[model samples]
Target: MTNLSLQAVKKAFGPVEVLHGIDLEIAAGEFVVFVGPSGCGKSTMLRLIAGLEEITSGTLEIGGEIANSLPPAERGIAMVFQSYALYPHMTVYDNMAFGLKISGMAKPEIDQRVRRAADMLQLTPYLDRHPKKLSGGQRQRVAIGRAVTRDPKVFLFDEPLSNLDAALRVATRIEIANLKEAMPDATMVYVTHDQVEAMTLADRIVVFNDGHIEQVGTPLELYTQPANLFVARFIGSPAMNIIPFDVLKGGDRPALLIKGVSETVVSLGPDDKICAGGTGYLGIRPEHLRVARDGDMALEGAVLVSERLGELTNIHLDIGQDDPLIIKVPGMIAPRRGEKMKVTFDRENIHLFEAEGLAV
Candidate 1:
């Protein structure tokens, strides 16, 4: 079935543990992406699944078989590494056929597979060209072609597009997405640091942090309803704004007090567990804040920087916080540098983080 399952999977190198008791499942044919910052163990988890690294404890199963002890080749999996790892001396055709030839596949069958894979990756024209003669995207496609020749039940991609330029990255991402469509039954696991890649390519994204999974959900779920402060800050561009504020006691409802040029108190969730007079963080995305209107909760700040990008503008505001608050205004609006302004956010869009950064 090519489904993968991990039962309390843990990995260690000598005395140091990287992945800690991770439990997950991937349905057959699902395109799952592991995403996180560098050193967050996303790649480590991918390596473990690929059998490139051993699991120090627990079990790993692929297609309903115990595969923890299986060598990578025996596990019916193929990996495309970050570095092309191609033999510069060999032509694309030879590179794609090398593994099949070594495995004693008939020349006719190897040729058939290579040609079909090349056609799928649109690398048919470059089949006779050597690695050094091909562009970055062509070389990557050749690598993918080599993997396809193996006819693996599972495919593992470790940041395959990171080495490409911006244009090539986009083109190759579309290629990978199309590849998944072409081979719907082949399970693929991709690891990347780019959230856009995770959002676009993944059926489900596993967000990793500090050697643990912070959250697992579709892109929209993670964007709209982050589980904790770490995820709220990590998933979005310019990040969600975090401002610490105090709560007032002896009120019918809780209120968040934001202090800028003026102190402003805004009402919070009626059912939240946060006690009155306690302190917590108020979280809002840059796109959520708007120019203050009459009777709106306003915080005064001066623009530190305004970045106009044709259709949208990003402004950095110094609101007496540890970090400058960023506000994103759509279309043709640039507040001048050092211009004082008042920004307000809809209460419904605000997020509350209680003590220990737990979302309320």
Candidate 2:
């Protein structure tokens, strides 16, 4: 097991700086995932950790040792790229044994490592099979096995499942998770744009935006108590519904008026505070909104579209806002187009963001 630390790390190309100062600590044997949109510097950070890119400033420590000057092979780290990068002509066994062979390891030791990795990855049955004979998921497993046979202290995966189809991706993801469980002492850092992957596989997730860290927390922490508007919108599927409003009364129990919805004065809980006459945003998840009962505070809107997705239905409503407010309902539902509907949410489920986009 190995721990990693990045102190004031920065990366730049020419005069263009992409990664702002980033400081993070990854514990030994912990699985940390970096997630963000494209061009967000997540991959660049991974490359820096793998010694594939030079850091313009700051320090990188691997296993309590300064590793900025170390070469990739000397860093005791193995990287699995998005592409499998397997040799087409070599069988699974030979491919896995290639690196150990080149390193002049004893024949018996090489065979033992290869067989052990193959069994761990469920690739033992296909050891003699060529890459062409393996499915996409199997080939990806072979790539992982090759890395495992090297006995690296740290493992870096750069969107390893992106190349596979949806079903194959899910299968490969499970395999990777199992591999982590089997090798509990191996430190891992994974980069992906898929939140599902980050949520399911990581012990902790680091959310990045542009070139800076947004927030770092467990999946549920990030989902439930986002640090700001960016994370609140980005972390959830279907995205949180944000409705702009003007603060009517300030203090512990502030009141807000929805910008587009007239005559609606929403009173926030005591924990929510905002200055008077300032703008604020209300964020609610689709699943949190429900059909309004009598005498409940509600926002009325006309149904724009309803998508029936097996287990649940996502109904888009036009409530005079720029974007349609979505409500997720259980089971099959086919609301009529332009049908007027009233929805309300609980006070605890509401997220209040100040004008500066910070959560109150």
Candidate 3:
């Protein structure tokens, strides 16, 4: 097991910089997940750590040793890609043990490692089966088992579950969570575009945006208190409902006007640099909005659509002047489209942000 650190790590292709000075420390035994949209340079950062790609600048350390000059094999890291890289003719057992054999390990040691990995991955029954005979999930398991056989200090997974079906992905995700539990000392870094996976699996999520670290924290922290508008909108389902508003107070008490809704007085003064009468956005999550069972901070609207996903329903409302706002209502209380509705949310639940996207 090892702690991995990247100090001011940057990557470039010719003159185009892809990663902009990433500084991160992955603690030993921690399951850290890098999550972002496509072209965010998350995969590239993982490749740099695996030594699959050369570091354009900065230092990379594994177990307190500088590894920038080291090759992939000597980096003490094993990588599992999205595509299960397996041998067509070789059986599962042979495929898992091939690397050890090529490294000149003793036959008995290779047998022990392969058997142990197979048992750990529940692949003992499929060891003699060819890749063509296994299911998609099994093939992915075999790919993971191959990496586990290496007994690497650090493990890198690049969207290893992307190719599986929804059901299989859930099962495999549990399998991976168990793998981390079993190997408590092994440092694992995962990269994915799935927010649900990131929220569920990671001890701490590193959110990347345009080759830079956007926000790094536990899933709920980033969701609840995003530093900027991009993260505020990006992390939530249906995203946060953002509407333009004016600051009503800045000299003494801080208050923001929500146009037709109501003027919300802040819990504290806008010493956060929000000027009076300046344009900004009011952010409120769909789940945070309260259904107007009674008249309280009421805003009338007509329902445009209602999506009932069994346990909960998402109501999209047309408020006339503003863009459509979604409200999450618990249970199957189906509200008809074009039905009149009133929505309200407490001042504490509302988020205030400056025009430049910064939270104020």
Best by lDDT: 2
Q: Write the per-residue lDDT of candidate 3 for residues 1-360, one digit (tens) a residue.
A: 699999999999999999999999999999999988899998999999998889999999999999998988888899999999899999999999998999999999999999998888889999999999998999999999999999999999999999999998988898898898889999999998777788888998898999999888888888888888888888878789987777765356665665653443433334545533377888899998868777465666888999999889999987754688899989988789889888888776777787888887
- Give the per-residue lDDT digits (tens) of candidate 2, residues 14-95: 9999999999999999999999889999989999999999999999999999999899999999999999989999999999
Off by over 4 Å in 1: 269-277
Comparing 1 and 3 on lDDT, the stronger one: 1
Ordering by TM-score: 2, 1, 3
In model 1, residue pairs whose N, Cα or C atoms come closer than 3 Å (at least 3 residues apart or on different chains), thus clashing, are: none
Residues 77-149, candidate 1: write the lDDT tens digits: 9999889889889999999999999999999999999999999999989888899998898899899989999
- Superior by lDDT: candidate 2 or candidate 3: 2
Every model's TM-score? 0.95, 0.96, 0.92
Top TM-score: which candidate number? 2
Question: Per-residue error at 122 for model 2, in Å?
Answer: 1.0
Q: What is residue 339's positional error in candidate 2, in angstroms? A: 1.4
Estimate every model's Cα lDDT from 0 to 1.
0.88, 0.91, 0.86
